[model samples]
Target: MSDTSSRIAIVTGASGGIGKAVAERLAADGLSVLVHYSGNAATAAETVAAITAAGGKATAFGGDVADEDAMGRLFQHAIDTFGGVDVVVNSAGIMPLAPVVDTDLDTFDRIQRTNVRGTFVVSQLAARTVRPGGAIINFSTSIMKLQMPTYGAYAMSKGAVEGLTLILAREMRGKDITVNAVAPGPTATPLFFEGKPQEVIDHIAGLNPMQRLGTPQDIAEVTAFLAGPGRWVNGQVLYTNGGAA
Candidate 1:
C-alpha cells in the first residue's frame, strides 16, 4: 500500500456483511474509506469505529444508492474529506428470491434500481472524478452462472453489474484505471440467510468445494487485490467460490 492517506474509497452498503468487510479491508490497506450506509446509522458508526480503531481513516455517510442526488453528495463527501477518490466499490444490492413468473414487478424494479442503475450512477461519477490509476470494483454473484431456481430476478440484477464492469474497463482504457467484478459463491452473510433455517444454511455451506460457506473476508481479500496490486486484471469477473463455478 502506498501512502493512500489522501486516496479515498467509497464503499456502498458498508454498514454490514460484505460491504463492511470490504470497507475494513480497504481501510487496512491504507485507503481513507467513505463508509456508505442506506439507513443503518448505528451499524455505520460501528464500521467507522472499527476502521479508526485500527488506525485507519474512515467516515460514515448515509444516502440512497438509487438516488442521483445522493450519489452526487457521496462523491462530493469523499472529495471534500479525503481530497479525491481513487476507488469506488459498488457493494450495495438486495436479493429477494422468487420464481420469475412469481416475482412481482415492484421487487424486480427495486432490484434493478439499486443493483444496475446504482452501479451505473456511481461508476459514471467515478469515471469523472477518480484519479488516474484508480479502480472501480463492482459486485456480482456466481449464481448467475449457476442459474439457481428462485434466483432469476436476483441473478438478472447482478448480471447487469457484470456487464457494466466489463464495459467500464474498456471505457477507461489508457486512463491507468481498472474496472473489475468479483463473484462469490454462497457466502455466509446475514443477508444470505435472512429467512433460511439452520439446515438450509448448513446445506449452503457444503455446496462449495471447500465444504464451507464463503466468508466476507474471503471476498474482501480478492477485492483488495483487484483494487491495489491486481490492477493489471481488467474487465474480468474473478470467481472466488471454492471452485463451485
Candidate 2:
C-alpha cells in the first residue's frame, strides 16, 4: 500500500445493489472510495455522483472483474487516484440458478469464473496492495447452508469463496490485514429478484426468522464494520441472514 493520509477503499461491482451500498457506507466512514463496475457506466456514475454529493470522495472505474490485466489496472487506479487502498471489497458476482443435474457446463463455468475466479483475481491484488490494519471482504451467500435446489452452482462458487477467505486470512499472518466473507441471505437486490416470482420471493423471505428480506444497507453495515473497526473478527464468514439457517 502506498502511504497516504486518508484511508481508501476499492469496491468492485459498486454500480448498484449491495456494492453500491457498501461503497457509500464506507465513504460515510471516511474512506476515499474507488467504485468499480463491469459495464454499467451510467449506474457507476450515479454511485460516484451520490458519494460526491454526500461530501465523500469517490471515483468510478470500468473493468471486467475476472480479467487479470483489467483488475490490476483497477487496483492501480485506486493507488493513482486515491493515493493508496486500505480496504478492498469483492462483491461482484453472478447468481444464475439451476439444479446440478440440469445445469449446463457453460453456465457452471461462467458462475465460477465470475464468482470464484473474480474473487481470486481481486483478492490477489488486494493481498499485495491493502495497507496494514486494512480489510478484504468477499461476498458469499446463506443459500449455501439453505441448500436450495436451484442454487447448486452458485453455492459451489461461494463455498470456494469461503475457502479463499479463511486461507487468505492465515496467509496474511503478520500483515495485520483481516480477510472475511459475508454470507447474506435473501437480500432484495436486483440480482436476487431478476426472474423469481413474488410468491417465490415471499417463500424465501419467510424462511428467515425476521420474516423480511434484507436490504442492501443491512449487508453494507456489516461490511462497514469489518472494513473499519472489526479488526479482531478475521477469518470468519458472518452470516447476516436474520436466523435463516
Candidate 3:
C-alpha cells in the first residue's frame, strides 16, 4: 500500500452522466481523481473544473476504455500524477437497446467491446496495480433482473460484469482489496434519456416503488461508500435501484 494520506482514484467515463457524478463525489471524499473520457474532451474538462473549483483535485484524461494499451496508459497516468491509486471505478460503458433477435451482430459486438471487454481490461490493470486496501467498482444494471424487452444485449454485457465482480474479489483474496459492481436501474442520465419517449420513461419509473427516476447523485453515493468505508462489502453486486428489481 502507498501512503494512506494521499489516496487517489481513477474514474473512467468521467466526462458526464453517472461517471461524472461519481468522480465529483469521490473527490469530495478527499481523494484526488483522474477523470477518464473516451471523447468529448470539453465535457471532461468541465468535470475537472467543477471539482477543482470546489477545492478538489482532478485531471481529465482521454482514452478508449476497451483498448488495453490505452487503459494501461491511463493507469500509468494516475500513478504518475497522483503518486498511487487507491480506487478504480470502471464506469465507462455503452447501452444500445434492441431485442436479441433484432440486434445486429455489429451492435452486439460493440456493446461487448465497451462494456464487457472494457471492464475486463480495466479490472485486470486495477488488480495488478491498485494498492492493498483499495477498491475496484464496475457498473452493471438492475434491468438484467427486470428482463425488459429491447435490453437483451445490454443486459448480457452487464451480466458478464456481475460475474467478473465476483470472480475478481475471490482472485484478490490476500490483497485486502474489494471488487464489486453497482447495478443501477433507470437512472435519469443523458444516456438513459437518449432515444426514449416520455411515456416510456414514465412507465419504467412507475415500476419502482419510488415512482421516480434516480438521479446521478443517488448512484454516486453508493460508489462513494464502496470506495471508502464499505470495505467489508466485497464480491457483491449492489443493486441501487429503488425497489424496481
Candidate 4:
C-alpha cells in the first residue's frame, strides 16, 4: 500500500487556476496529491514541482474527465501511488458566456459534456473507490443563482453538478464519505476573465459587498475544510463567494 499513513487527494483540472490552488492547499495540509490536467502537461508538471519543492508530495496526471475508462484508471492510479484515495476534488469545468438564443449548440454540448459528464464520471469513481472517511468535492458556480444573462449554458451545467452532488451524498449512505459542491462566485481565475472586459469586470466586482472578485485562495480554504475536518458539512452547496451570491 505504499506507506498509507498520509491522506491522499485526486484534484482534477489542477494544472492551473482554482484547481491548482486547491491542490497546493491540500498538499500543504499534508495530503499527497494527484494533480490531474486535461491537456497542459507542462503546467501540471510545474504544479508537481511546486508541491515537491515545498516539501509536499504531488504527481501530475492527464486525462479526459468525462472518459469513464480514463477516469477509472485515474482513480486506480491514485490508489497505486498513495495507498488509497481520501479526497476527490472535481475542479475541472468550463465556462462559456453567451445568451441562450446566441449560444451555439456545439458550445452548449461541450460545456455540459465537460462540466456535467466530467463531474459525473469522476464522482462515480469516487463513490466507488474513495476510502472510508473520505471526501468528494465538486465545483459549481453562484452565477446560477444570480440568473444572469449570457450564462444560460454555463448555469445549466452547474445546476446539474449541484444535483449530482446532493444525490450522491445520500446514495453513499453510511459509507463515511462526504459529498458536497463548492459554488464560487466570480473568482479571479483565468476561467472568469476569459471573455469579460475591464469595465464589466469592475462592475461585477463592485456589485459584491466586498467590492472585489474572489480569489482562488479564498475558494481553496473552503475546499480544505470540506476535505479535512468539515465532516458534518455534507450534501450542501456551500456558497463560498463572500456573499457575492
**All candidates: CA RMSD (Å):** 1.0, 2.1, 1.6, 2.2
How well is each residue in 1-245 modelled by candidate 4, as lDDT tens digits?
Answer: 22333899999999999999999999998899999999999999999999999989998889999999999888888988889999999999999899998999999999999999999999999998999989999999998777889999999999999999999999999999999999999889998999889999999999898989999999999999999889999999999888877
lDDT of 3 by residue, 1-245 (tens): 32334899999999999999999999998899999999899999999999999999999889999999998899999999989988999999999898788999999999999999999999999999999889999999998888999999999999999999999999999999999999999999999998999999999889889999999999999999999999999999999998888
In order, what lDDT does every prediction score? 0.90, 0.93, 0.93, 0.93
Using all chains and alpha carbons, the TM-scores for the candidates as numbered come to 0.97, 0.97, 0.97, 0.97
Rank by lDDT (best first): 3, 2, 4, 1
Question: Candidates 1 and 2: which is better by lDDT?
Answer: 2
Residue 48 of candidate 4: its Cα lDDT?
Answer: 96
10 residues in a row with least lDDT, candidate 1: 1-10
At residue 103, what lDDT does model 3 achieve? 99
Q: How close is candidate 1 to the true structure, as a TM-score?
A: 0.97
lDDT score, residue 5, model 1? 66
Report model 3's TM-score to 2 decimal places: 0.97
lDDT of 4 at 120: 95
